[model samples]
Target: MDQETAKKLLVEGGTFVFLGVPQETQFGIDMQCWNTDEDFRGIKMIPPGLHYIHYSAVSKGTGDIAPRSGIMHYFQKKEFLVKMWDKDKDDMSREEVSEESIQRLKDNLYNLDRHLGPYPYEIWLKWKLLTSQITAELAAKLSPESGIIRASVELLSTSDKDRPRGVKSPEGSMDQESADDINTENSNEAGQSTAKRAKRATAQEREDAMLPDLKPAPGTALRFTEIPRDKYPPGSTPEEITKHYLDQSYTLELMIEQQEEPLHIIGELQFSYLCFLIGHSLDAFEHWKELVILLCSCDDAIHKYRSLFFHFIRTIEIQIEEMPEDFLADIVMNKNLVYKKLREFFRTAYMSKVDGRLLTMIERFKENLTEKLQWDFTGLDADEEDERPVVVRLDDDAE
Candidate 1:
């Protein structure tokens, strides 16, 4: 898909995944890994911070990706931004990755590939890793039934060279209002030095707030309810189990039908486990591999879930609390076995789809996934919730 389309998918479709919209909800999966001293072995320790992502999928042609024209915002990184897309219908091998395509990805990403002299391919790999991680975290949060992601995405319109050297927050002059309840400003030298004291949410911070509220519980995955004998017959065959499971949701039914739409129909089911996580209170990372297995094993009509497994992994990152960066790196590297199992699940699901609702169900599944992923992380830190963004009250709305 072209970059514009990808961006749209990342935005619109991605929003659905992130926001936790109603049915037609998207589906995604995640796995979290802890980065402790043992996992790192002799390496340096990870800094304390959150690191997770969400991953969601859509048909290649179903979304838009053109560069947008508006305030371009993103988390700043020292490395060159590279935009990778499938052009000329080639695999992602270095040989097939044309210079023009690479340039395009760079240009589309940062908009100034010419200025960036030259960097090793490993940099791109890091970008991919980061992207994969981000996507996976997002997907995991989105895939669950309670995946309440509450974030927004905007396109990067301006060229890198044309962009400002260091963009400032829009309301830099604003300060915390006093008890009198009116607007106030803290002007200092040239409105620059005081910038440090200004507190506006970071993109990551905002995203953190946007995460689904699993209060009383912690993560999005639903806790498994004991399957009564009525739900699944005693000694039911694996095939029967699969079929019975598929019969539960209309989303899954559509996927099995697999109409001629470009999109694939994957099965739809709310993560019962996520509800469990929210109600029972649990960490998102601990059950990473199991979630991955479930997602990778979805029996969609087209059977192309493999292409999007990593995307699912990236989505998972958002639901969990952030981790230290170095620790995240270790988990990514050492968790090779988990991926193998995930791949196997994908194979198994493809083999299991007998009726065909899997493809259509994919859309509904995504719809659901997005709901769990896009959550409002902002909680009443000290008191009850107030509907207005500007103020808080102990009781009664502030008129």
Candidate 2:
């Protein structure tokens, strides 16, 4: 931003005052992080917009900390908001402070003025784009009623406890095994002592699984009640399978079949993104992962769900674009796992007989992802004619 614009934003921006947090607690808004001490009590001159505020409580003598928590809020110009941290609970208490207390705090604002710091204007635009569509109402709707997300949280599960990350309910590890380990067996010698049987879901896994995912239950997954497919008798042909697919509903059917409105879907997507990338909530991230995979795997539904896919692409595009510099660094340190999985789905649909509009949108989505992340997917798509089989002459084989 230019100096004039920066100054203007500074003059017009809002503020968030978080009080009572201890001096050494880790706290941040958007992608910025700072240790709270007596010198600073609030963020000032913040661009008036929707932002995800997250924080963690540091432990003494050890790095271990409680699960991180995040909340999305929309700030308006010149707005002032305050929260009183609960030391006992290790969070900002949800109960409202009495009006007398509010007035006392307001009166002391002048005394505390020097502790507030200006917003990092340099990152305003990036943050704006990331949260443009996330509104306070939407956040409220998707968040847990009590306004917290914890490690023990799960989504829409009937179980009594919050499921931990990476463990399926009542099952062993869901981590995928390597291809090289396909046929490997337990390393027990002939008639030698056998190793103890693999344990079932650990106590930790059991606890995590019972934690309900705080998101609105419906948005956890797409709702496609029914999709017709041909069930041919014993000896079905390729033609039969093709016909079965054709018999399914037309474009956007899967999305339209949603029990909830499209707005709910979008809100859920935004919520999941916030949880994973910002809140660092593993369960939310898992849901986000599953949703992305489910959408990408919609090769059979792509044509029948064209509009849905179109909106889905835009939803994911914005989420990717909104990723913070720090978060993106962590996400891609190994590999862009989310992007790679999405690319697989896109490539699969592209290789299939997908709707033209959906295909074009998919390409555009990939282009945006590449541009935003500086990623290279150059070799993913290939010329069909180059890879397809060609008719050969008998004489050519002789040569």
Candidate 3:
């Protein structure tokens, strides 16, 4: 920025004071943090807008940090906020600094100015993709009291009294009676062991029985709603299944609520994408995959939410382009839900007469996938005899 603009921003910008954090801590605003540092305070001249500040305390020996905690804050111009590190409690909490002390710090601002770093203008474009929809209003409506976006894995809690056998006890403790009963009942009447029953719960079972409880738990940083999925009756024909899905998916358009437009779902997508891809959170990733699948599975969805679906495609394209190569490879090689959804989109677009814009966008996305990942989805067959997608490899540059 030019000197004049910098001066104006300095006059109008907010000052965040973080006091007493020891040397070499990992913390900062989104996508930017301290490294090789000592006596960290906080960022200054911050733009008056919605921003997320996160931090983690490093472990003593192993150097493994604790789960990161984050809070979303809106910095009004000239706002001064103070937070102190509770080394004993192991957290950053708001502190009530006396006006005299605050004035002293303000007067000696030159001493602290050396520690302040500029907002990362270079990566703002990319960062905005994940956070642009997060308005101050939305943040205030949903964030925890502290306004921090802490990402942590949540395991479903199961009641020991009702939990089925073969599942480990919640407390990792097994009663002697239960162990004896299991051993006695291990063999069937015909002498075959019932060990086959010990399989881990399936994805569908986990989703059906568990996920609902963990979401929106009192301190959950982001609100992720359950994604809709299509279920077909036993012995239903493919045609009937498709019709049912289309009918069900069409009804989702009515789900928009006050302060939430159709495209606001994109905000949820961005939230889940970050939670999954960057936070390494399975539940968030599950929501992301389901959302994509729900949109792509319905051929008519592209028609109903054309612009939303178009944006969805572009977002995924960017995700695929920017994600680590190894992670993308795992997503494709494992035929995960995301990979399957992309395949399903190609199949749906091929079989139906989708919107021209959507069709072109999907084609371009497919071309990018083919070029970058060697995923060649050239044609699809939804016929009764052969309903699988056809993969035809062409020259690397082929459209």
Candidate 4:
């Protein structure tokens, strides 16, 4: 679909909820039912293309949704659903939104608190009340088995202003556990459906909170000072420069290469090193894979830094896993990237730039697998062990 269609679908099809907060922090967490292009309410279909649900909250003006509280949630279309359904073909199809099928979703959403975790009061109240009414009205618009598409409703919590407008709190007979299955036939509907917009924050507050704080963490050798690329050959693209650095056709040994400016080379090296460093801290395997791809982009084999870089990476990974919990926190918060320790080691080995030694190399990349399996097998035993002393080896207590 075109961008305009995509943007329209986002606002129309997606469910918006707000996480009420006083600050103008525009952050959201979206969850998409990727099995079907349809959403939880089966109200709209999402268009394809790297589809993702945008769960963001817009800040309230001084007196819109709340005096200073912003919108709890922002809505966006679930583009990921198209990809997910493509991958998981056996999953429910959009055509299968019969009464039987919708009942399952209803059961799931109603029991969401039980299935996942407790939801906020506003979400619990709004979804329960609105969906119940919508479900009952199904017979009027469509068959009970026929899928009824309702305009996606924004689920929200009752603000202090909304509370006094004859909104009745759920009666004492309504058990929190049983509240999920509230019968729509007996419920009252909310009136005056409207979207409330939040006010803008002052320029200073916006600048302070919106931009990423890229300061160097304490104890790290690196310092951030944004240097413009005016010094480097201005026309060279980042990708081209990186490729040139790693090109086997080029050799650092060639004396002619020494006359070239250093900024491009330094920039490429720092970029690769940053990727390698971040790979150590990333929890997801996919993220590490992406980092590996980034590292490969800096592959200038003529410089002959392979062995040192590989071993440096190995050491960082091992040391991060080996660090005590307290020390790990310090490394994470202060030393910055866990692999940054390798930078100093790299500097020390700069003279022997072609050194084949790995400073913290593991015998094999077996530690990660073994550690993962140990936790998987230990299950709840792992939680109990948090209070116990950590052993140097998994078999430390074994004969």
Least accurate 10 contiguous residues by lDDT in model 4: 65-74
Query: Which candidate has the highest lDDT of all?
Result: 3
Model 2 TM = 0.61
Instruction: Please count the clashing residue pairs in each candidate, in the order shown.
Output: 112, 16, 5, 18
The numbered model that scores best in TM-score is: 3
TM for every model, in the order presented, reads 0.22, 0.61, 0.70, 0.19
Candidate models: Cα lDDT each: 0.32, 0.64, 0.67, 0.30
Better of 1 and 4 by TM-score: 1
lDDT of 3 at 323: 69
Q: Write the per-residue lDDT of candidate 4 for residues 46-99, one digit (tens) a residue.
A: 322111122112224542221111111112343111101112322112332355
Which structure is stronger by lDDT: 2 or 4? Answer: 2
For candidate 3, the lDDT comes to 0.67
lDDT of 1 by residue, 47-152 (tens): 1111222222223465432211110112222222222222342111113335675555434533332222211222233233333322223334334344332122
Superpose all Cα atoms of candidate 3 onto the true structure and report the RMSD in Å to 1 decimal: 9.7
**Residue 140 CA error for candidate 1 (Å)?**
14
The RMSD (Cα, Å) of candidate 2 is 11.3
Cα lDDT over the full model 4: 0.30
Cα-based lDDT at residue 237, candidate 4: 87
